[model samples]
Target: MIIAVIDGMGGGIGAQIVSNLREELPTYIDIYALGTNSIATSSMMKSHANKGATGENAIITSVKKANIVVAPVSVVMPNSMMGEVTCGISTAVAECEALKVLLPIMPEDVEIVGLENKPLALLIKDCIKVIKKEFNIK
Candidate 1:
């Protein structure tokens, strides 16, 4: 199965996700790192994503091939990530056929009601569980 991990800015979150997935998922599961900038992509690559791409067009194109997409909720919000995430990028991600697993990470000036304010590590672990369930990975 192919999974895409999308992120922006410094990509610390994506890096952690990639690292954890590398450890937990089977080697056959391909992880694609889609980043808003080169730095983010590089960070994820360091975490051992199978492949990576950067910028709007790259993200738009690569996300189409993924069976699942993992990203912060901000990835779908245009003008988020300090304006690194464009409308096209957001639209592409939202419109893609892949099942999306988004972290409830609130960006500046935005608030998501009813979600517990959990630590990022805990949230990432939950994301792994969702992936496991979706792929029926034991």
Candidate 2:
């Protein structure tokens, strides 16, 4: 399966996701790191994503080919990530047929009720759990 992990800013979250997926998933599963900037892509690559790309076009094009798309909730919000996520990027992700596994992290002004306040690491673990179950990893 091809999984695209999308992130912006420092790409720390994407890198962590890639690293954990690399360690926990089967070797045949392909992980693609899609970033809003080159630094973000590079960081995820260092974490061992099978492939990496940067910019809105890259993300828009790549997510369509993935079986699963993983990202922070902010990724779907146009102009988020300090305007790094364009409308096209957000639309592409939203319209894609791939299953989406989005972290609960969001802008300060946005809130989703009934969600536990968890650390980033814990959220990622939970994200992985969902992916594993949805993909029937076991």
Candidate 3:
């Protein structure tokens, strides 16, 4: 299966997701790191993603082939990630055919109701649970 992990800024979140997936998921699964910049992509690449891409067009094109798209909710919000995420990138991710697994991370000036404030590690573990269930992984 193909999984895409999308992130921007420092790409710390994407890197962690990639590392967790590599450690827990089967080796046959393909993990793609899609970042808004080269620095972000490089960080995730160090986590051992099978492939990595950066920039708006790269994200738009790569997500199309993903079986699963994992990212923070900000990825679908235009002008998010301190303006690193463009309208085209947000539109592409929001409209992609892949099953989306978004973490409930709110950006500045945004608030999501009905979600408890959880630690980042806990949220990431929850993400892994969803991935495992979706793919029927042991």
Evaluated with TM-score, which candidate comes out highest?
1
Scored against the true structure, residue 56 in model 2 reaches a CA lDDT of 89
Inter-residue clash pairs, candidate 3: none
Tens-place lDDT per residue, model 3, 50-119, is 9999999999999999999999999999999999999999999999999999998869799998998998
Q: What tens-digit string does per-residue lDDT give for candidate 1 at 1-138?
A: 899999999999999999999999999999999999999999999999999999999999999999999999999999999999999999999999999999998688999888999999999999999999987998
The better-scoring model by lDDT among 1 and 3 is 1
Quote the positional error of residue 134 for candidate 2 in Å: 0.9
lDDT of each: 0.95, 0.94, 0.94
In model 3, the worst 10-residue window by lDDT is 119-128
Question: What residue runs in model 1 are displaced by over 4 Å at the alpha carbon?
Answer: none
**lDDT minimum window of 10 residues, candidate 1:** 105-114
RMSD, every candidate, angstroms: 0.6, 0.7, 0.7
